[model samples]
Target: MPIRTEIVSQDRIVYQGDADMVVLPGIDGVMGILPNHSPVLTALQYGIITVRLKGEEYYFTVAGGFVEVQPDQVTVLADAAENVAEIDVARAEAAKTRAEEMLKEGIPSDQDRYLMIQAALRRSTLRIDAVRRYQQGRRSRG
Candidate 1:
């Protein structure tokens, strides 16, 4: 049995479909969810979310959120989420560069600000990496 999954961001629903499996970037580590898995409600980290459906895989870059898992469904309420297909490579690159520069300069005076910047850097990096990996996969397959 496939698990019903929905990923929602602040602006819109990022994805909604039935997936055979889902791998989420959890706070502790990656967590894989399958059909009939035990119930869980956990905080997610900035990283990639992989969904497998009908033998095909979909990738998304998710920036921190909470995931709730039931016996039959999984829901991701993300701070921000973008599909690999929708990602603009140039924009992601620019954001990554900006984040890197900010990190280099250091926001050490404020712990909260420093951590927030670090998270942004991580999100940007994950997006760039995801897009490149998707493009590479397409090229290899085609």
Candidate 2:
């Protein structure tokens, strides 16, 4: 049986569909959810989320989030999420560069702002890498 999966970011639902299996970047490590899996509620780290159906696979980049897994459904509530195919490489690159420049100037007095920049840097890097790995046909199982 396929598992129903939904990935939602703050602004919108990034994906909603049935998948053969879903792989998540759990805080403990990667976790794979299949139909009839045990229930779980876990925090997610900055990484990739993969959904497979039949022989096809879909990849998404998630910056941070939480996932709820039930016997037949998986729900991801993300801070930011996007399909690998939809990632704007140029924009990611630009963000990365900007972040790097900011970091080079030294940490901001506001620790929160520094942390946000760091998170942004990580997210942009993840997006760029996901596009390079998945969109370029280097599809290894996530």
Candidate 3:
């Protein structure tokens, strides 16, 4: 039996489907969920969420969130999420560059603002890496 997986951002559902396996980037580490997985709720980190259906894999970049897993379903409520295929490589690159510059210039005095900037850097870096992996996978298949 496939597990129903839904990923949602503040505005809309990023993805909703049935998958044989789902891997999430938990705050502590990566967690893998399969059908009949035990129920648990955990905070997510800025990283990747991978869904496998049949023999194919789908990748999504998530910038922090929370994930809940039950016997029959898995739900991810993300601060922001984007499918690798939908990501604009150039835009992500630009964001990464800007983030690096901000970090290098100096840390902000406000702890919260500094943390937010760090999170942005992490998210942009993850997006770029995800896009690279997606492109590599496509090239290998093609």
Candidate 4:
């Protein structure tokens, strides 16, 4: 069975289609959804959403949001999202490095800097995952 998915952002819909399964980055952790799963709504985390469609894998990086599963239909109201194909690996790598430096310097003792660093790390990880997936797709295609 297939589940309908809709990935949304404030500006537009990132994706919508039928998928065999969806792997989400939940606030608590990652979770997989399939057809006939129990209904529930939960908050999202910065991470990857993997979709299995027609035997091919697709990946999207979502920066937090909400997820609603109603029967076989799963909808994700993502705060921000980008497909793997859209990621800029160099930028993501730089962000990751900066976040690591901030984490090490401990300048967040007074500011939200620490929290922002954590957020940057999450975003960087999401981008890295997306880039890896895209590269894997390229390799598989070739």
lDDT of 3 by residue, 65-138 (tens): 89999999999999999888778888988888888898898998899988888877787888889888786543
| Candidate 4 pairs with clashing backbones | none
Candidate order, lDDT descending: 2, 3, 1, 4
Give lDDT tens digits, candidate 2, residues 49-80: 99998988889889888999999999999999
Native-referenced Cα lDDT, model 3: 0.86
Task: Write the residue-wise lDDT of candidate 1 on 23-60 in tens digits.
Answer: 99999899999999999999998888888888788888
Root-mean-square deviation per candidate: 3.5, 2.8, 3.2, 3.6
Which candidate ranks first by lDDT, i.e. highest? Answer: 2
My TM-score estimates for the predictions, one after another, are: 0.85, 0.94, 0.88, 0.78
TM-score for predicted model 2 compared with the true structure = 0.94
**Model 1 segments beyond 4 Å from truth?**
105-113, 137-142
Give the distance in Å from residue 19's predicted Cα in candidate 1 to where it truly belongs.
0.8
Which parts of model 2 have CA positions greater than 4 angstroms off? 137-142
Error of 1 at 136 (Å): 4.0
For each predicted model, how many residue pairs clash, with residues at least 3 apart or on different chains? 0, 0, 0, 0
lDDT of 2 at 38: 97
